[model samples]
Target: MTVDRRPGGVLELRGVAGGYGGATVVRDLDLTVGSGEALAVLGASGSGKTTVLRMIAGLHPVSAGRILVDGRRVDPLPAQHRGIGLVPQQGALFPHLSVAKNVGFGLVPVDPLARWRSRRERAARVREVLDLVGLADRADDRPSRLSGGQQQRVALARALAPGSGLILLDEPFSALDAALRGRVRAEVSALLAESGATSVLVTHDRA
Candidate 1:
């Protein structure tokens, strides 16, 4: 399956289809997100919105079709090797780790033989993202100590820490209360725009 490359295309899903055994949730989907653009997939609950994101993030296998990032095929690659960031529905932070440490987790080299970044460099990157998320003051606190909105921000910081060109957000604001959801949604929209990342966000909410 070949997709004519679109100029500035950062994320592309061509004829993508996937689902659990014997049940096709996403079928022949085609989508493209340009550089620094944000695409939202909105649907009712159980509508297979997150499945599209997982397929692109390499968390869920694509039964058919191609996933491309920056013009390169990424469906064949491991999740970590795809050079894409994913913010799962839950913040998925480590309760035992400090906010700063959780955000810095991606900065650590996965391969023992790979060159590790300097502690200062990693710390600086963590701090940079924490500031962007307005959580710099909470850096030393654990995820358990923060509010739901705050934890989500930490997750966003962690996802951005690696500076991935494409980010997949799976209902990032769903956990927040009604009062806080809108605020966090706006903040996230602004932050994504400021970061200049190509992002795909899936949610049940129309707002």
Candidate 2:
């Protein structure tokens, strides 16, 4: 279920197979994502695109195959330890926190003692990512006050804040209006490129 490759790409999935239970949704899937590359997995509803993404993000267990990042096997690592940036369709922002806090959530305390940053350092990192996603002005606003596209940008910024090696997008713009969707999609694409992040984006829309 695994194979080694040249030292370049940030992600590689080999012979991956898994599903909700014993039933397999994705079978023997193989893929690679080079550094600063963007890959889209396009499929209709129930095509297991999200399942594949979840497996990559370590949110769902892979019953078979191996997942690698930076040429190292990460199948045994927990989701947080894998250093993945996962952007689900719902945005998943914290309703109780400000936009700035939501984006800074992961940078400081996923493990309090293991990786603690000073308050100023954490704020700087948060601002850097918020600015990268063009949400610097909305940092103080709550998620409730932001538009769908804005919220998605915040979610992405949050993911990018931790400087993860890979970004997994699960139809992040599906909830936006047509114009907003196009705009945000382009922005997200450009942001990833600018950040040199290896990404796998899953969406049903072919556009």
Candidate 3:
């Protein structure tokens, strides 16, 4: 696979803390992920691993601390404007959309330069990321037609289509079978490295 280089993938979380209503599940979390690096946050169920990712992705409010991407504080921005990609558990591919459309969702309106303003540009980008994920042949298929692992790849392609600097994966491979889960996780890790996107994977799996 050909690698594409881009600027601004560094991620930093300083004294980050958050939780539901009155309780704090995560507190004082500080970490930095340089461009092209992958960090795994391992925890058991209900251990606040997903909360950390949500805080960074801006889905959950941060009760304390700051989140920065390439030295820019993104905690203040909305989820779509944060320039961070997220692959949630079970892939979360839309059943109504084709693989190509699923991957192209983020490329629309999220790019600061509006580089994918045209349909042709967006299609090309979707195809490029699909190829990266080895799903070029399944572009026309619906999410329901794909296997669990393929759906996860499509979810990843969606997250990557906009070329987000940092990727947050919340147990993305949990729905796959044991054998498939290992294979997909390795492929995802390699793809993130090749793409040079800083990544944080929160999962119960230690392997």
Best by lDDT: 3
Top TM-score hit: 3
Candidate order by TM-score, decreasing, is 3, 2, 1
What C-alpha lDDT does candidate 1 achieve relative to the native structure?
0.84
Per-prediction tally of clashes: 0, 0, 0
What lDDT does model 2 reach? Answer: 0.85
The list of candidate 2 runs beyond 4 A from truth reads 1-9, 111-116
Model 3 lDDT per residue over 118-192, tens place = 889888888789998899999999998998888988988888888787889999988888989888888888778
Candidate 2 backbone collisions, by pair: none
Pitting candidate 2 against candidate 3, the one with the higher lDDT is 3
Task: Please write out the lDDT profile of model 2 over residues 1-207, one tens digit for every residue.
Answer: 111112224799999999975888999998888887899999999999999999888889999999999889998889988888898898999999999999989876667664436888788878888877788999999999998988998998888877776889999988888988899888889888777778899999999
Better model by lDDT, 1 or 3? 3
Model 1: per-residue Cα lDDT over 100-149, one tens digit each? 99999988876554332689878888888888888889999999999888
List ranges where model 1 is wrong by over 4 Å. Answer: 1-9, 111-116
